[model samples]
Target chain A: MANARVIVITSGKGGVGKTTTTANIGMALAALDQRVALVDADIGLRNLDLALGLENRIVYDIVDVVEGRAEVRKALIKDKRNQNLAFLPAAQTRDKSAVSPEQMIKVLDDIKAEGYNFILIDCPAGIEQGFKNATAGADEAIVVTNPEMSSVRDADRIIGLLESQDLRGAKLIVNRIRMKMVEQGEMLGVEDVQEILGTGVLLLGVVPDDETIITSTNSGEPASMSDTSRAGQAYRNIARRLLGEDVPFLQLAEEKQGGIFAKIKKLFGG
Target chain B: MLADLIERIFGKPEKTGSVAKDRLRVVLASDRSKIPPEVMDKIRIELIQVLSKYLELDDTALNVSMERDEDSIALVVNTPVHRVREVKVS
Candidate 1:
């Protein structure tokens, strides 16, 4: 509530790691002893609960609280990993239009008063009404995107809309980037994506497609706990960086293959 | 990075269908630039609105499009003037 940063985790297109980033980043921030609340603003096509592995624990949702059926504090679902981490689940039965931008603003304001260092919103995809409502209270946003064309394009559209709302410092979080695809010219690299979007936005982080993220999503634990997963470390580093700590960029995936001799050595060692 | 490593070891593109890749390229360019298709309509409407205010012009005969390069957006306006000399050139 003191000096919290309200950030919306959004993507112009669906399936672009918005929810995963929200879950992991919220968990990472909480793990760092920062009070964090992740709001599920996806409404109808909500997956934040499932991604955070709290789908089963959701008895009351944001819609219930907004509709006065439940209190805002009562709808808050505490995470298993960190008690400081709380989640506001979206209504599965209700559509995005069921809640207005004003309701979302009120809920966020209430949570801010509860003493959170960072409030993350897992926003739904597309530049539709859902996107508009989710970003209403967002002080800033992290546009989650992949290096792929559609993701980048959608990210650009979202960036434009965010700018229209007068939200400054909207950062980019490049997710599931395959560095090999960039090397061989099959996919656009970081520079290409950045150039196309133009400058002035900070690169919050680049997340690799580490299998542990998928596994963690499946098991209901965030990928931040996976020591072997490159993405887990990346999310933790992002959390530290968000806290104003100077963490160096990590290699999510090797850009080059191992030397033939090393490959042969690995084969022998195996 | 894994894709490139696999391609290097395999020594070829992963699959066929560069056309599918082209579709991605085109769509991204259009969508990411935040250039809506509705802008073309607005251009036509504005042109007709302005032209009608001055000389009588056929609205259906005009063509509005964008000439895009690696940089800059150029709004192209093409219209046939029946009497060029009679019309006031702006």
Candidate 2:
């Protein structure tokens, strides 16, 4: 088996759906038969476990593993839904300072020996010590952002930080996009955000703003696990793309009009 | 929807997206260059003050900013000097 590739999901700003993206992507990847491990690197503000609905199953966290109080295997919580998936929750009582980058590296190195295909680290918001610790052991980075100014700006900063770390190029996942708003000129379109952030950075995927995400989080099941939600399909597409599959982008926006309207639009050179 | 499509195809000339693009370009350029806003403002003021000693110029017409391309960042300063005045040296 190949060594697990550590990837960190990060956004410089909070509440931009980093945790949600991490959970769904991990779950989706696991569903693809890849042995995946999701690490909650938020430290004191732990939430990835909650997003995974494994909050109640945590016995030992990362801090305990780093402190040598618990073995790495003991600290890892296997997902009930997927036999190949696992989680390493962060300590809730301790802060980011409790864990060192070297410790994280050691823990991840141990996890790699267990023959995982992917390791997804859920980084905390902001470019602080927590972010530093999260990205320390990661080999690649995925930046989650909203189709807005503040989120895009912060994502730019995060990308710069990732570049400085000498890690692989950071790919973007634009979340919570409202196509109607873009069509109405009320919000930035995907192309607009891409233009501002620079096209040199690759785009991994886009997730539309779906009401099912809220319901999924409330129920402790990732939206991607659902069979009928568009957001879930989007995440699944992202997972497939990550696995080197050429999946076409989903057409989330409805068609503008019918046969006559389409003909008119074409005639207008639209 | 047809109207919207036609407008988009021909273009309504909506400046919202373009405005954001322009603003983000300026902001990201400065951010990537690691130049603080206050420092940039100070540099602009000092450049104008020093240049005015020799040339009659329009301060409002002056523009000091940075631009970026694929490879490098450029410092562009534009001072609209009306005319060059003759001076006698001892």
Candidate 3:
């Protein structure tokens, strides 16, 4: 807990897979033998619990812990699958105003005292009070974005805001990329997003769009637990990178095109 | 319909990815500077008024835009000057 790294996973735009990224990365970090505590800071719109398949296990929420109704440990729900992973769900009946920045800092401090090596806060969308509360106690940030114009623009805005708050060196994670679309020039590539966002934000990892992610979410199982899922492998790599391991990005283009290209070439008799 | 046919024959129109990049470049310049188009116009008009007191300017050719680079953003102004106004000593 003394050297625990408090990182907030955020994006300025909604529906860019912030909660999914948080759940998967937390699971991956736990798999790597790190003590991980995932805090859902979305307040009323609580989904990290469901994503981690721990929604039914949460008895006390963050509001209860902050309001003195329950202790921090009592509010935290340990992942049934992974002993190293724990989660604190947000209050479903409250809004963003239910918790203040100071209270969030205190809550994180409490979680840190529980001896977690990594405390990942799943930040809510928008540049509002929820965002502030999520980032208040964070030492670093992971900005998840989609390779789309609107998402990239919002990410730029978030980077600027984070810099103004003196929270510099926030890493980027471009999620839900369709490699074929990037190769065909129909979607924005990672380089275009990096160029538009500037170089201050470093690249953390890129998760490809995988249909298994949806199925895993629906089943309350994180995709990171799947060995065959491309998105899952990407999240696992991101976790290793967080642990100071140098893991190269997955060769997504080749993996996505190899089979199809071979078939096309054979059909052309080349 | 002719243009559409030509585009179809040409194997598709311009890639929208490049178009998005171009649009983002322009929009981000203004977004980063915190200056909207109306504010930019106001700044241009005020600049013209201040410069007119000392120099004769060609307003038609004047240009003002926020230019962005990898490190910084600059309010680039290209104001063509017609002539310098002579100052009279009392």
Candidate 4:
């Protein structure tokens, strides 16, 4: 009966940017005046803390909370940048099997009762025990994938599994889209991915491939905090959409020739 | 530079996105069915064994694959029957 909406950010293939998405989305939500908690469910391969620059502050983790070694409040790490944001680090020494789905549910239930507005779980790659544990108590899901065949294939598999789990159908986030490549027809476009992924899921948002994301991650400052970053702005729009706001998607690329008339035509055609 | 700019303004580049789209369409269809590529090979072998008794068929001519559409998975099996065995006179 808790009011918190628990959402899991997942991708079946590794290195498809699940951790980065979780960190950015959590930071963006927290910036919007919501109490946000990011749970790193990768267990042994925990890196969400590093993305958030909270690696040094982790004395206790999710495993410790589940095992009763430390209280939940003691294990939660406060974000230096945002007072509303908190992070629950994962145990780097233990494997995914150490945490069960039931344990994950219990932990989420406890976090929900603490008055968090949103809980974003960073699920590990692969459709294994780690994935099951991370998604055990999620009310909705956000499936992340790149603009390549391998990532999209894995994402389709993950979507199939998520639908069968009886939770709300997943929202799709096509990440790392290079507009140049997409225009050149070298990479899959957003519409192409949506067609192959089917109409069962809604398109949450599209994030362009931006270098600012890498720079921000390296500096432990989320791009969403920067007004100049294109990827950061995309994430902000997504956050607004999640809050039920009618925000227009950002125009990342511009046409150089026939600009005004072409813009009108494209807008009407779309 | 002028030619390149003109091409940018008007030329239609070779559509490589369609390549990714086509490849993903087939691969994801097969993947979501939970049947591995190796399992399809196994099915081909078993199917040949069962069909070889009734007709003389070319072993290399058989194909077993999952055809995927927007929402359904269809198991397609194609094999050419070269010659059927004639029944003996009673």
Instruction: Tell me the TM-score of chain B in each candidate.
Output: 0.48, 0.57, 0.60, 0.56
Clashing residue pairs, backbone N/CA/C < 3 A, model 3? none
Ranking by lDDT: 3, 2, 4, 1
> DockQ of each model against the real complex?
0.14, 0.31, 0.57, 0.61
Q: How well does candidate 3 score on lDDT at residue A44? A: 96
Q: Residues B32-52, candidate 4, lDDT per residue (tens digit)?
A: 676767888899999999878
DockQ of 2: 0.31
Give per-residue CA lDDT, model 1, range A46-152, as digits (tens): 78888788888988999998989988788898887679999999988989898899988998888888888899998888888898899999898898888776687
CA error at residue B48 for candidate 1, angstroms:
10
Candidate with maximal lDDT? 3
Off by over 4 Å in 3: A253-270, B1-12, B35-73, B76-90
| Cα lDDT tens digits for candidate 4, A86-201 | 99999999999988999999989888877899999999999988889999999999999998988988888898889878765799998999877776677898889999999877
Candidate 4 Cα errors over 4 Å, as ranges:
A255-270, B1-14, B34-90
Q: Candidate 4: which pairs clash?
A: A185-B16, A185-B17
In lDDT terms, how accurate is model 1? 0.82
Using all chains and alpha carbons, the TM-scores for the candidates as numbered come to 0.78, 0.80, 0.82, 0.80
Cα deviation of A73, candidate 4, in Å:
1.2
TM value for model 1? 0.78
Candidate 1 scores a chain A TM-score of 0.92
How does residue A56 of candidate 4 score in lDDT?
Answer: 85
Evaluated at residue A174, the lDDT of candidate 4 is 89
